[model samples]
Target: MKNLFPILLMLIIMVNASAHGGKNHEHANIFENLQGNNKAAILMVHFGTTHDDTRALTIDALNKKAQAEFPGVELREAYTARIVIKRLGERGIIKQKPQDVLAQLKKEGYTHILIQPSIIIDGVEMESLQKDVVEVQSQFKEIRIGDPLLYSPEDYEKLIDVLTKNIDSETAYIWVGHGTYDSNTAQYAMLDYMLKARGHTNCFVGTIEGYPSFDDMHQQLKASRLKKVVLVPLMFVAGEHAKNDIAEDWKNDLEKEGYSVEVKMEGLGQNPEVQDLYISHLKFKSAHRKIGIIEKKAIYEVTGEKME
Candidate 1:
């Protein structure tokens, strides 16, 4: 696994920037000094959840944090899930797409646009958002995207600190996340390594769609001789995947394996530390606009898991 920031960022930005048109190397840091007529708005992009309760705790909560951090910037929301948007439409509710949201920001005379993704990994959903970004790139005066949460090694270190805060030291934790089909899925394995490196022997990360599956979790726990397992959702929202998949499905399955199971049923956004990181990612771009565009300071984690 290659954890070099420039290489990973090139991949991330190549996919993300491909949508936002070309950027000229004007000032190394475009956001260096701006005062008059240069207004910026934050577009918080998410996968979205139909469950209002989870949306309130996870997505809405995170957006509120963003608003509090950047007082003046207008914070708009966009959901990548068309199904969720469609379902909400059936109920007379309208959710905006990122492209439409960016277009509206442009019309409002917002000069600088910062797109902050609350994604855990750089997966297909993140890629989809990048594609949508292409349409409105020309409309906006200046648009830039902040990196996902897992861009730097420090991110994983902080994640281990936050995610494992409430976990009992003695009890094994099985964190379940929504996995991807691509090589990006190796992120889970890398996360697993980070957790262990932090001396978290009892905590393991698994996914519903990708590698480090429930089966892998089972075997890992058995290897550690751990019979008491706590199931936690690694999702930003504790919606269907958390409630049904981790809390219920995996819990029941693990219980059947003679392992005592407990559920946390909390979203990643609930953790203040986690929210702080997202805010930091946005803030990092304001001071370092040259990053990813020209000079990236973050280094990538070279995972043996085929980053290519």
Candidate 2:
């Protein structure tokens, strides 16, 4: 019996070491090893908000997740609208600017860049992001471009899974998307359809600028007698709209209308699953480099390509 105890202890130690080694291996592979100045850079392109604090919070969440998952890769964050607004307001005209951003990246020795957009739905912002990508690609000789995040149908299904964690069919789930004036409105329809397809009947997707606005969902919620609603931003960060417009402003209006309402402000940005989705997308593109470019272009044509 005493002899048996030592052998059991040795076996347990081996098991623990093996498990720890596996985790370390995963971490090492995720970050990748780029010696000297050849490391891959991740550019998280957000539809910049005028509110600095909100934008910081949103970008920080994504960066933190990326840093955690990929311990070594360099990460950069930029806002398209806010950057353009500042440049135009200060300079009196929009400067053709990819050199400044790429210059810094080039100085740092980054050759491959994966641009991830925080855009919820397709729109003019995505088109602008694509332009930035093309401009950057032109600047760097060995640059590899990653598709904008919402460019994938899997993103919608991933969103459904992420939201499902916070809510159930009993509670009304309302996702507030930033709708575009352009034909990218189909992305929201995809969001709505995927949500319903996932068996979330009490769920509805509404946009701030497009159809099924807050008023539309509010009326439906009141009419249906659902007292509790979980409001999630279809955005990267639970910014002004999620924090103020929906939780405080809209809830106050709903209460005045004599409907008992409960609001849960859990933005998709904070969801780890969403972060994992982005990481997986990155890894897939990185692994299958040849087909990645072709597949990405096809997706862009379907999702971001404008209609006549």
- What total of clashing residue pairs does each candidate reach? 13, 0
Tens-place lDDT per residue, model 1, 114-222, is 8899998877877888788777778767777877888677788878887877777779988888998789889999999889988888989899998988788778888
Off by over 4 Å in 1: 1-36, 291-308
Top TM-score model = 1
lDDT of 2 by residue, 1-308 (tens): 87866755644443344344332111222225455646677666665545445544555676677667666767776656656558545746433334356668878877767656656656777677667666667655444434445666776776677677756556677777767656777778677777778777788888777766667667667665676666667777666677787788767876787655677665566666776676665565444332234443443354453211
- In order, what is each prediction's RMSD in angstroms? 8.6, 12.9
- Candidate number of the best lDDT: 1
lDDT of 1: 0.78
Worst 10-residue lDDT window for candidate 1 reads 299-308
All models: lDDT? 0.78, 0.62
TM-score of each: 0.83, 0.69
